[model samples]
Target chain A: MKKLKLTVAFDDGDYVVYAKLHYDRAPNLIAAIEKVVPFSNPVRHARICESEWMLSTPYLGVEDENFSYPDPGDISLHRAGPHFCGWYERISPIGTTDIFASVASEDLEEYRKKMGRAWEHPGAKMTVDIVEVDA
Target chain B: MNPIAQELFETGDRYLMERPEDIAAMRSRMGTRGQNMTVQIYAFSALGSSVDAMYLLQEAVAKDDYDFDTVVKFAVDWLSTLAPPADGSQGAAIIGHRASVHYRLDQLADLTSRASAALKQATTRAEVREILQALEHYYNQVRTWIDLEFPWHELAVKYAELMGDPAPRPAP
Candidate 1:
């Protein structure tokens, strides 16, 4: 099976990072995310969970699957706000989440800086879409 | 110690016991069916209002000399307003059946207790402001829980009058 990849672009593609979909662990969530690829939304910082960006996805209808504490660069779907979360920096576990993808390790630093900016200056636009890549 | 700070400390201590009791009583009343959804709606309104109150408090603290006595007085007054009258007046009642609410309130008690102790030691405006900031952080945690637990738009629609219209108020 070909592993899926997602492109996360911040500020209208000014900063871009690649994430690999966890097809094995969260196949259903991955499928749900696929349907919404090429999506754009405003991103905000999380209040409880430190060093993370929350992308509102009120449209998602998936349930919990493989929910657990996230490491840096992990992307997960949190059904409460129905937020698509991106953890760019190490964060303490507020609660478990159904992770579907993770940013490339090499891109973690830049991703951390971009997501951290939402703390000081929120309402930045983030675009997500599937990308052709071998992982 | 400033008299206002002393009063705030006392108020905080009172709330550590009173607020949770109010909610627990509300939960008991709710279980009896003596009260209706109106009580829960009012309780939700109280929770919603706290978010606004925190924001206002934050603004007041931003000023260098923002009248500490007035701020303390407001804080003292607002703490009481969170609970409905135990006598069940004005069609209001407190509501908290979910263990999460009780647990969160316990966490809130810790913050208040810390704030009260800090009140005794804080001699400078900056110190007081820091205490307020800590309170704001705790409020934010509760706000997050509320957001996760309840749908504000649905609540606003169902209890339109109690929830108040979401008019565009000027930013604080």
Candidate 2:
């Protein structure tokens, strides 16, 4: 069977995280996410949520002019491996941050926890609000 | 042939005769000039992978009741981080010579937008085929760029070293 691919970019006023996903393995990954949260039409709402999520953690902060998205030429779908992959940059504060601690330890873990709770009941759709932040 | 070129040819010939999969594996292993080549290959590989992923999602959207927005976002989120390890000054030269990393990122964003649109409207098989074909073309272009930049011999030597063998051919 062929694989399914999707890409996402989050502009948090100061930074952008570009990501790609393989849908074949994670068919419900996105829907599962939507079930937990709703997308705010304006980008800033999500930004604030991401920021709030980061702020709650000691290791996370918004950086200046360090934001980045994926290189256009660098897109692809691997036959086997992680379902998704991509790069990110700090846009506002400008500096390198620890990936394991900032993303894996704090943000991703939090997301997983929240998602778990939202998914506790079958077919429960979580409402996510994305409010646009001023650039 | 240039010394580097000659070594690459010998290495490739030896690998073809004895270790074919090793040749492919060499492309993935990092370090030295081979790592540089691998980065270039990876840049292209990213494109091919993106296309493959996009095609898959398009197919799913067509036949299944999937959340299109969520799926697109999921794909984009992953695509944004597809980078080779930030080592190798040699590879940096190649990547910079082509364009700064930011340029590549912009291109990816544009492609993602296109893919998102295609997915949103993907109701027929032909449209999906077209999107996949476009991705295949993008992949081919990346391969061509790699070929032009590294040629076969330098790539072979790099591959040989990456495979943990001493430079496959003796110095001229």
Candidate with the greatest TM-score versus the true structure: 1
Which stretches of candidate 2 lie above 4 Å from their native place? A1-135, B1-39, B65-70, B78-133, B158-172
B66-136 per-residue lDDT for model 1 (tens digits): 88767755653454344221222313312332222332244344344445445444566555654554444
Estimate the overall C-alpha local distance difference test score of candidate 1. 0.54
Each candidate structure's count of clashing pairs:
0, 68
For residue A90, what is the lDDT in candidate 2?
Answer: 22
Name the docking class for model 1: incorrect
Q: What clash pairs does model 1 have?
A: none
Q: What TM-score does chain A of each model score against the native chain A? A: 0.87, 0.21
